[model samples]
Every structure is written in structure tokens, then in C-alpha cells.
Target: MLKQYSFEKTAVQSFDAQTTLALKTEDLQVFYGANHAMHDANLGFPKNQITALIGASGSGKSTYLRSLNRMNDGIATVTGKIWYHGVNINEPNVNIYEIRKHIGMVFQRPNPFSKSIRENIVYALKANGMKSKADLDERVETSLRGAALWDEVKDTLDKSALSLSGGQQQRLCIARSIAMAPDVLLLDEPCSALDPISTVKVEETLLELQKQYTIIIVTHNMQQAARVSSQCAFFHLGHVMEYTSTGTMFSNPQIPVTQDYIAGSFG
Candidate 1:
């Protein structure tokens, strides 16, 4: 049985005035039927930086990440505002498809389309009216390179994506997401299925991509969060218990609950 834990709400941390926010959520809440899955979450993601959401199982980290780009649509009731570029994207009539293009997501598992490696990256572009062959080719290479998979797969672009190893496939999925040129990328436990080497590669890719994209990642591995993210948020029992810089949060947590969790007393 899981141990039930209660925590007091601590103020979410903030970046300095000069740091620009790429995205933010205001009073966010999510519900599955009558069960409240996430509490009111107010958080900001600084531009060109990585922010990791850390929590144990069923702590609402994934719930909050999915709600950012309206992935919870048709499945749950998501309330509050997701602010991006001065617009509240959670409005009732907003175009979720359009919003998702600007804020792309990679799932917990590596889900490559059953198509050629090249096709997997270009399919979305073609569906969205990218008809120029030269542009598509350029995008394919650029995206793969951005994911750090170019040299290995450049010679086999015509081969089936499934032919690649697990780590390669996951990086291909990252390339697919990058092809769309999103302003923010959300990854949910992207390395859980990968081996140690693969996990390190993915972590390195994220660190490099942070220079060009605002990244929000959900990671169960506290070490990964400490390595890749500039800031971290600790969630517990549907509430954001604390948010702070990774260094401070790990070295000297402000909340008792955070300290306990980091110390491995309880998840």
C-alpha cells in the first residue's frame, strides 16, 4: 500500500526580472471525473532553459505537463490559463491543434511511426502543407542533427525507423518533434525505457536544445532532473510542494517535505 503524505503549500520560485518566461500556467487544475488529479498550479518556465517536474508516481507531475498543451482535452476537465506569448491558450474556443504545433510533446515511450526514418520526421510537415522537396530534405537533416542522430542514420534514411535500436528510435522521435520548430518542448520520462548510455545521450541532447527551446521535462529520476534542469518543481499529492533552483533544492531544500523526499525517506 502507498503511504499517504500531506504537505503545506510553498510559494513557487521565480526567476529574476531579466529572465523571460516562455510559458506559464495560472491557477491550473485538472480533474478526472470527480477526482481532482491536480491542484491549482501556478508556475513559469523561463525561455531557453530546462525545468524539470519531479515527483513520485501519481503525484500529478504528468497530469500538469499534459494540461499545458491541452493534451488532456476530451479526457479530463482542465481549468485555468496556459499563457504563451501574451495569449491565454486555455480559452474554450482556442485551436488546440495550432497550440500544439507551437508547444510539442514527446511521450514516455519512444513511439516512432511505422515508416522510413526520413518519413517519420517529414510526415507532420507534409500534412501541414510543406510541399517543397528541398525544404523537406533540409528539415529532415536539420531535425536529425538537432537530435544528435544525424551521422548514425543519415546513411539509412530510407530504412524503416524500427530497424534502429531503442535509443536511436527515441532520438528519432525527438527529431520528429524538433522538425516542427516548437517554442517549448515537453518530455514525460523520455529516458525511462532507455539504457544508461542512451539516457545520457538524451540528457545531453536536452541540455544542448535548451539554448533554442524552453524545455519542461517530467522525470522520476532525481539525478536526471538535477543534471539537466536549471530549475525544479517538487510535486506531492496533487500539489506543488516546492519550486526552486536545482542546486538549492537538492543542497538545501526550503520545505521539510522536499528535504525528506530528496533524502529518500519517502517518495
Candidate 2:
């Protein structure tokens, strides 16, 4: 069992409400067995905005991202307090499946199933018991277009997903995630394995998606963070060194550690 604290008690004394803001963490802490992966992390993510979590390896960047969608619980031992929709996600009564429905995730590597591209997207809807053929068709097409890969594959929806290039496969994964209509999309270093052109395509897709979903991305690329995020968070040793508008963070970081990290003193 891990001890936890309320957001108001440990993090922000006052949290201003936002129509677009979809998720918030107040003094969130996470431990894998005895290892504390995250420490005193606090953040507020506005809806329709992009937040980039940037840090060196083993800095708890991905750990913090996983907590939002309750993906960390599969590990043998995990504990943390996360809040979405004004309720504590770590609470016993909270439904994990329901939480994940609204909070989608895209992993670092594209893991498309050994199925057709159209089937991959439709399977999600079908599994969720969505039976409307018209709606399913609309969702599948919309999500693919949203990921910027529809035109290329629209003619061959039945084609095997495995046939796609690395970049296209990643986009298909994104399309599958979006077909679920999640309010918050969590991306963990999604472009690390992609080529330069593919990386730009992924970033561009995210930029376009920000109009309807709150986006949180964990990336080691400082330039990528600076290029795509509206807000940037720098993490060091499980601690959030600073969180602020991207412009302010890169130009004039409030904390010395954040400034040092930005200057490439140490990852």
C-alpha cells in the first residue's frame, strides 16, 4: 500500500477551473514496488491543448504519463493518486476500464495487430459493442483522416496493417486510438522510431487533433517538445522541475534546474 495525499492538500492550494482543462494531478506520487518512479508531480492539462513532458531517461516521464490512464497497475506493485473529472482515479471504486475509455494512449512503437487496416480500427468499435454500421464507417474514416493517412490507404481499407511502412503503421495505431473518441490522448515517445518525414507527420497530426482532445506527450526530444507543445514540463529524478508555457520555459525558466536542463548542462 502506498500513502497518498489530496491534490488540494499536497499540490495546488487553488485550482482554477477551465472548460477545456480535462485532467489534473495534485501532488501525485508513484512507486513500483519500493522504487518511487514519480515524486510530487503536479500538472493541469487544458482540453484542446498539447502538453509535452520532457526529461532524460529514467526521469519518470513515461511513468507519470501512464498514471493518467491507469496503465501502470499491471506491474507487480504500483501506487499513485491521479485525478480526472474531479474524482481520484486511485480510489477503490473507480472503474479502470471506464477511465481508459476516455483516456486513450499511443505507445512508443507502433503495434498494429496482424489484421487489415480497416479491421484494426473497426475492431475497437465492435468490441465496445458499437453496432451502428453508418457510425462505425464514419468513425473509421474520420480517425484515419485525422491521423493524416486516410488518402493513402482509403482505396484499400482491407489491406493488411503489416504492409504499411513504419510511419504509416504508427498512423494506423493513432487512427485506432482516436476511433474510440477519447477525450484525452496520451502519447509516449511516439515518434522516436520514425524517420524525419514520418516524425513531422506525427507531430502535424497531433497539432490538428488538439482542437478536441487534451494531449500529453512524453518525449526526450527537446526540439520536438518546443516545436509541438503549447506547455512544456521538465522532469528530473521523478520530480517536475518546472511547468509553464513553452515560450516562457525555454526562454526564461523559473527554476535554476529547469534553466540548466534547457541549456544542456545535464539531462
Candidate 3:
């Protein structure tokens, strides 16, 4: 039988005024029909840092992440204050498209377009009215380089993106998101579908990316969380059970639920 832990004892960390937060959520809740998938999830993401959201499946980590950029709209009722640059982006009148432009997302599986590698990166830019050949060329190179995929795919820019391996496809997806010049990059299990070598490459890319973009990753792998994230948040049964430094969360969790989850006794 699975043990039922109390939800009253949660440890969520908050940043000081001196620390600049790239994104924050206050009183964040999510509901789908009659189901409450997330509770009041208050958390802050420091600028130019990687924060990993780790939990077992169905623990609401992805739900809370989707709400950060209003991805839960029309899918779930999210009532909360999602503050990005002093703006409550959760407001009804906020432009979700614009919000997504600044806060990009990369899904679990790599979903690159059927177009060529160069076209894959330039498609969204062209749709957004960027027509300068020189600028478009620069963005394509820059984003690809940023994602650590330029060297591998630069020679084959005209080839179909589908021809790349699983790892390459995922990196191309990351390049696609960075092509938008977003401030925050949200990744939902970006490495869950790759080989060990590919996973290492993705992890290395993310570590480098934190110098330019704030990253929030939802991963079920504890080792990956410990390797890439400066901070870690653990979710359980629709609640954010703990948030702290990656070292502390894994070594000395403040709550029992977090301790058990980390110890592999339960999740």
C-alpha cells in the first residue's frame, strides 16, 4: 500500500530583493473540470540560472510549468499571478502569443519541422516579419550555435531536419526556441527521449545556456536534476512539496515527503 503523506508541511524557498528573478508565480492553482491538479505554487526563478522541477508522474510539475507562460489556457483553469518583468501575464487581456515569444517552450519529444535545417530556424522569424537576408542568416547561425548544434548541422543546412538523429532533432528544437530571443526557456523533459551520450550533450548545452537565458526544466531523472540545476523544486500530488538548492534538496530535504521522494522510498 502507498503511504499518504500530509500536505501541510511544504518547504518553498523565496529569493531576496537583491536577487533578480526572471519569473515568479504567486498563489498559482490549476483545475481541470472537477480535478485540482495544482495547489498554490509560489516560486521564483533567478535570472540566468537553471531551476529543475523534479517529481514523479502526475505530480503537477508540468501543469505548474505550463501556467508560467499561460500554456494552460483553455486546457485548465489557472488562477494566479505570474509575474514576468513586473507584469502579470496571467491577465485575460495579455497577449499569449507575445508572452510565448518572450518565454519559449521545448516539449518532451523533438518536433522539428519537415523543412530544411536552416528553414526550420527561420520559419518563425519570417512569420514575425523579419525579412532581412543578412539578419535572418545571422539569427539562424546564432541560434544554432547557441544550442551547440551549429557544428553538427551547419554543413547540411539545406537538408531536411528529419534526417538528424534523435539528439540532433532535440538540439534543433532548442535552437528553434532560442531563435526567438526569449528571456526564459521552459523545457519539459527535453532529454527523456535520448541516449546517454545525447543526454549528456543536452545537459552540457543547458549548462551553457543558463548564462544567457533563465531555464526551468521538468525532469523525472534525479541525476539530471542534480547535474544541471542550481535550484530544485519537488512536487507531489498537486503540491509543491519542497524548493531549495539542488544540493540541499537532495542531501537534506526539509520536508518528509521530499525526503522520501529523494530517498526512493516513495514518489
Summarize candidate 3's per-residue lDDT along 1-267 as a digit string, tens digits.
667989998899999999999999999999998999999999999999999999999999999998888899999999989999999999999999999999999989999999999999999999889999999999999999999999998899999999999999999999999999999999999999999999999999999999999999999999999999999999998999999999999899998888888999865
> Which has the higher TM-score value, candidate number 1 or candidate number 2?
1
| Candidate 3 stretches greater than 4 Å from native | none
Residue 177 lDDT (model 2): 92
What is the Cα-based lDDT of residue 57 in candidate 1? 91
Report the candidate with higher lDDT, 2 versus 3: 3
Which TM-score value belongs to model 2?
0.91
Task: Tell me each candidate's TM-score.
Answer: 0.97, 0.91, 0.99
Report the alpha-carbon TM-score of model 3 versus the true structure.
0.99
Best-performing candidate as measured by lDDT: 3
**Local distance difference test, each candidate:** 0.92, 0.85, 0.95
Could you tell which candidate, 2 or 3, scores higher by TM-score? 3
Badly placed stretches (over 4 Å) of model 1 are 1-6
Model 3 Cα shift for residue 47 (angstroms): 0.6
Specify the highest-TM-score model's number. Answer: 3
lDDT of 2 at 167: 95
The window of 10 residues in a row where model 3 has the poorest summed lDDT is 1-10
RMSD of 1: 1.3
lDDT of 2 at 105: 94
lDDT per residue for candidate 2 within 9-102, as digits (tens), equals: 2211223653446888877888888888888787888778999999889989998998888887767234555768778887667898888889
lDDT string, candidate 1, 1-267, tens digits: 555556554847866778799999988999999999999898999999999999889999999999999999999999988999999999988999898889999999999999999999999999889999999999999999999999999999999999998899999999999999999999999999999999999999999999999999999999999999999999988999899888988999987778888998777
